[model samples]
Target: MLIGDVARHSGVSTRMLRHYDALGLVRPTGRTVGGYREYSAEDVRRIFHVESLRSLGLTLKQIGRALEDPDFTPSALVGDLIRWTEERLEREQELLERLRAVDASAPTGWQDVLRIVELMQGLDSTSAARRQQAVLTRPEGVPVPAELLAAAVLAESDPLVAGALRWALARSGGDGVAALTAGARSEDVDVRRRAVLAIAGTAEAPGAAAVLADALGDPDPTVRGHAALASGRRGVTAAVPVLVGMVVEGSHDVEAAEILGTLSQDPGCAERILAALTGELAAPTADSATRIRLTQALVELSGDTGREALRRLARDDDRAVALVASAFVAVLDERSPEVPGAEVP
Candidate 1:
């Protein structure tokens, strides 16, 4: 076939076919009667092969080697192509995210757009100080949208920067809550933990309570523990069981115990907290330290149930527990006549 015919039949532009010939990638070996360059069937086949490999993100150089180099294996080259494609996709996704954030901010002019972009760059900076500065900007400054801060906080690894991001997010008037709720469902454990911590700081925001309730059931104990403490402080009765469990595990047990004490303000809640604590106290895993922490927690409780439990522990088989409990019982009796139980918040 003539080159023009090959171009017409194969749908390759004649210009590209000439380029391929010059590169020795697909030179037609046959000559027409007019002595013009002509494509043989095999040459046409090679042209189609190059196009096929090119569609798989192969560079022209790589495709040339794939077709001409007999020893060239495809596995490593295909893996490279995959990696390159993945990197490209990641960059595109980041660009898209930036665009979405800018659009969400609803910039009214180029200056507003520039300010939003600057804040985003600051938040994404390698220096934690820069990121924190972005978050700590005064409200009258860049006017960065809440979603941007929410995204930054979810991914922030530096404790100082993360705290600042959370602090900024808390004052977004609940604008950050939706992003935070999605973050709470992240597969990354650290991301979920950060999301829960942010939610805790923003608990006064609308929808914060429901998200906190959901986080209480998270498989990561740290996530669940914070959720429990936050929710317990919010007076959600659901946090009672986990707060008691925190006392047993000694993970933030003091805070957990204190929150438990606060939750005990409800007369019915007092009985529940008392029962859960006493139940753990009776468990085989209740070590002396566990019992003592639980004891101090019991003392923080409001009703006579705490004092009553202390009186029983005064005779605990563990000598140390008995002494501590006996001492606490005496203190409780002395303070009991002097002050009434704390009023429920």
Candidate 2:
């Protein structure tokens, strides 16, 4: 077959076939009587082989060696090609993700595009300070997309950077609530914990409360604790049980107690708080140390109910509990005179 015929039959471009001939990668076996290049059957087969190697990302030089070097084993070269292809694919995937983020931001100009790109790079920086600064220094007009902030907040490991990212997400007007809520369902407990924490900061956002309400049921105790605290601050009564549990378990128990006290100001919440604590205090399985912690938490409660509860606990059989509750009752008595109509029992 002639060069044109080989090009036509093999689907290889004539120019590329000429380049392959120049590189000694492929050459016609003979010439026609008219002085045209004539490809024998073996040359045509080599052309197909070269094209096949090219499809596997082999350079022309590598293909030449592959065909000519009898000592060259393809296993090592194929493995290297696989690695190179993987690296290229990774780069392409990263570029695609960046492009998708930019497209999602709906940038109005080059400046907006650049700002988003810069923020993304900053968020991905190895330095925690850089990540924090990325969130803290977000330009006023060129807002970081809520989705980007949500992802960063979920993945952020540094406490300071995570706080900054959560603040940024909150300022996004709960636009990233869907993304954050998705994170809350992650199999990764840390991701779910970060998700709930970020959502908690978005309390002012429209759907943040509902998302937190849903998060309160998360199986991860950390997730539930954050949701309970944030929801409690927002006056969600549904968080009462979790808050009470936090107090008993000594996980942010002080904050939990304070919030419980605040919630206790509502019509019937005080009785519930009192009942819950008293139940924990009265549990036969609760050790003396556990009872002491719960006793300390009672001081955080509001109204005569908490004071009176302490008064009852002051006489408990557990000496540590009695001593702590008695001491607290004494402090309450000393402070009672400061209030105009306060009665100390």
Candidate 3:
């Protein structure tokens, strides 16, 4: 057959066939009397083999070497190809993680309305009500149909979607803590963060503390921060040690300070939080915001010590920290002084 006939039969382009021929990778058997290239059925079969190797991610050079060796083991080539595929998959997964982080940083819009609507239908009526509130409040305006929302919330079983819906509900003043807790186990980091936030907001939910505790160790700093905040907001004293550890050890020091401030409202958590900020914990550089939060937490946990710390921090180089400390001290001064015999102030 001619080059065109061989190209069509083997599903290889004519240009590629010429290139392979030039490389001696899969040359035609012979030339016709007219000096035209001639390809036999055997050549077509070899072309198919080359296409298969290319599909398996082998370079043209590697495929040529394999094709040259008649005694080559197909099993060995397939094993190497499997390893290559796994590496590609791992790289793709990493890219996907980075993309997800980027996406979360941006604003949500109508482009995901259909997908969100579809996912929302898998929830119950109460859950759907919460999602509706969130959708209506969305900056993009409500473009999703009511039926689609109801159906998607009712039909889908995906934990990620469920977690998002439950989070929307909690944000809308609905009690979806049960749903959020259920979604905390999802492989999706965003879902877990949303679940942690929801559970933290709902004070009455059972097992919410445990879920938030587990989330403190999440690989993603964003998730860990949210988890820390949830633990603090819920006033889970058991999480004090963890929250203090985060303030001292976490990479996101700003978030850690915020969580520490929240946790410091509990008098029992005072010592741990103070230790985190005082250089005893040896956390990396303490920024103005972190120092401010630490001072605020100390005030909430221990009035005298916190006031003293605030007085000292008021002399800090960072104007923002000094300003906050000054403001807190002024507020404390404006309040009536406690008399020795006065009722509990």
Candidate 4:
């Protein structure tokens, strides 16, 4: 076949076929009487082979080595191609995400588009300071997409940066709640923990309280603790059980107790609080340390029920428990001058 016929048959352009010949990638392998380049069947086959390799993102130089290097093995080259393709895909995905964020913002002009792009780049920066600044300085009215913020919050390992991201998410008015809620369900414990914390920070958002209430049941104690603390502060009665449990477990028990004390302002909650503490105090399996923490937690409760509980605990058989409880009872008695006759059991 002549060059024209070869081009027509192979669908490889004539210019490209000539370029391939010049590079000695697929020489004609014959010359016609008129001296025009002529291709044998093998030459056409080589052209198709080059096109096939190009489809795999192989550069012309790489293709040449693949075709002509007798010692070349595909293992290393294929691995390199895979890496390059993956890198390209990641870049493309990132670009797509940025475009989506811009579109979501409904940018008014090129400047808004540029600002969003800059903010995204800053958020993804390796420097924690840059990421923090990105969140701290997020321009108002140019909303950063909640999904992006939630993903960053979940992955951020720096405490300062993570805190700022959480604040930013909260400022976005619970827009990130759905994303953070998804994060709360992540299999990664750290991710779940972060999700709950972010959700708690956003508790002021319209639906954030409900999301936190849902998070209260997370299996991860850390997640549950955060959710309980936030929800308890928000007066979500659903967190009562978990807050009581934290006191018994001695996990952030101090904060839990404080929040529980606030929750106890409700007469019904006070009864439940006292009952939960009394039950934990009487549990034979309660470790000495756990019992001590639970006893101390009672001091944070309001009303005489807690003081009376402390007084009863003061006479318990466990010397250490009795000593701590006795001290707290004395303190409570001294603070309430009206109880002049109050004494440790």
Candidate 5:
């Protein structure tokens, strides 16, 4: 087959066939009577082989070695190809994410696009300080996209940098709540924890309350506790049980108890919370430490219901419980404005 005929049959351009011939990659096995290159069936088959390997992202030089080197094996070359393809895919994914963020921002011009790109670079910087400054210091009146901030917050392992990212998302006025909610559902525990913290800062934002409510059931205790405390502060009665549990378990018990006390201020909730605390104090398994925490929480509550619970706890069976409860009771009886700390165990 002549070069032109070979090009037509194989769909490889004649110019490319000549280049391949010049490089001895697929040299024709014959010459036509007119002194032009002529390909035999075997040469055409080799040409097909070269094109097949090229489809796998092999460089032309690598393809040359693969086709001609007798001892060359595909194992190492294939491994390298896989790694290179994966790295390219990762870079493309990052670029796609940046483009989506910039599009979400609705940039007005090239300058806006440049600024957004610069901020994204800063957020992805290895230095924690740069990431933090990226979130904190955007151009005047050029709001950072909430989606970008949400992504940064979820990936940031550094506490200080993560706080800044969360704060920026919070101030975006719920624009990124959906993104943060996605993070909350991530399989990664750290990502979920960061999402919950970011959502807590925006507890007043639309849909943030529901996210926090859902997070109350998270498997991680820290995520659940943070969600519970934030929810309780927002007056969600569903958080009461979790907060009480925290007090009992001694994890962030102080904050949990204080929030519980606040939840008790509702006229309808007041009785329920007081009963939960007092019931724990009276449980048979209640130890000195548990009773003391319960008593301390009671002081944070208001109205006659709290005073009455403290009055009953003042006569508890345990001497330590009785002592702490009596002290709180005396403060309640005197109607003093302030309550002192509970004595050590």
Candidate 6:
């Protein structure tokens, strides 16, 4: 196939094909006497794989290395991509914190100001954690500011806050399980939240299951959502039932749907949860946001099932419910998976 045919077959633009060729990432199988690129069927396959890895955030260099080495594993590549993503997230968090600080300094209503202040404080804590991660992971020999880092760690007990601190410590080659577990059980809601979130990031911890289970029933939906997400992260089979139950009976449908979505990432749990949702059981909640999330989760589980459910829900007379349902239908339709082994959207 010529360059145009190759581009059409691979769904990559001609410009990108040239760029890949230039980088020696995906060279053409042959060249015509006229000097045009000619790609083999095998070349098309390689291009598609390259696109998939690029979509997963692999840099061109990383992709080249992986492609060049027969022993390179997809899991190893994904791990590297995840590390890059975390670094980007940390930088974005820093920029967000700086923006929040400016907003806090501006004149505003007392309530708004207070909220901004709280947000700024949280951002500061998150940035501190990111910095700690950098210090631990990067090869640059700059020493971390221990006193400042300690103060950042001790500032407040928000689940995200505590989780970040614990994550930083762990990344920095320290095991602070005792302190993290203590924080998880603290009387302070923030501290407990942090503990739950932090433990979720680790592979397995002794008391994490109990702590997360306790958090599942927290009065605050924020706490409940974090706990439920953490439980899903732990990948405990017991959590699947509890998370599904929350979807059915919890007042906060949005959070419950999020937990359910997390659980549905497991194939068995996904099938069971979809059956429960599409069954004759009463709709979990009438809230549009909740319904939208549930519909999306179902779609993720099985597009046809999710599409049918959304169509049924869209028939409701409630304007908000119908609107969100329609949106869900549109999203699924656009991204619907191919029936006979082709990509959906």
Say which candidate scores most in TM-score: 5
RMSD of each: 4.2, 3.5, 12.7, 2.8, 3.9, 27.6
Quote the lDDT for 164 in model 6.
52
What is the TM-score (0 to 1) of candidate 1? 0.86
TM-score of each: 0.86, 0.86, 0.43, 0.88, 0.91, 0.43
**Any residue pairs clashing in model 1, and if so which?**
none
Q: Estimate every model's Cα lDDT from 0 to 1.
A: 0.86, 0.85, 0.61, 0.86, 0.85, 0.61
Give every collision pair in model 6. 157-190, 157-191, 158-190, 159-193, 159-194
Which structure among the candidates has the greatest lDDT? 4
lDDT of 3 by residue, 1-345 (tens): 999988777788999999999999888999999988999889888999989878889999889888887887778778888998999999898556444433432426645644443333333334645544454455343233322332233333555554554444444333345545555667876656555655666545666677778877777665666676667666666556556555444445555556566666666676666765565312456665555556655555445445656666677677887788777767765663533452221
What are the per-model numbers of colliding residue pairs? 0, 0, 13, 0, 0, 5
- Candidate 6 residues 1-345, lDDT tens each? 998988877788999999999999989999999999999888888898899878888888888888898887888668777898999999998767555444534534556454444434444544656544433443333222222233345454444544555555455333444446666666777656655556566535555577677767766655666666667655654555555555555444555566666666677777777777665234644465545445545555433545566676677566676677777767766786424542221
Task: Identify the superior model by lDDT, candidate 2 or candidate 6.
Answer: 2
lDDT of 4 by residue, 280-326 (tens): 88998998898998898888887765988888889988999999999
Stretches of candidate 2 exceeding 4 Å from the true structure: 65-82, 331-345
- Model 1 segments more than 4 A misplaced: 1-5, 29-37, 138-141, 317-319, 338-345
The per-residue C-alpha lDDT of model 3 at residue 88 equals 93
The residue ranges of model 4 lying beyond 4 angstroms of the native Cα positions read 139-141, 284-288, 330-344
Give lDDT tens digits, candidate 2, residues 65-91.
988889999999999999999999999
Residue-level error in angstroms, candidate 6, position 322: 2.9
User: What would the per-residue lDDT of candidate 5 be over residues 18-108, giving only the tens digit for each residue?
Assistant: 9998887889998978899989899999999999999999988999998888999999999999999999999999889899988988889
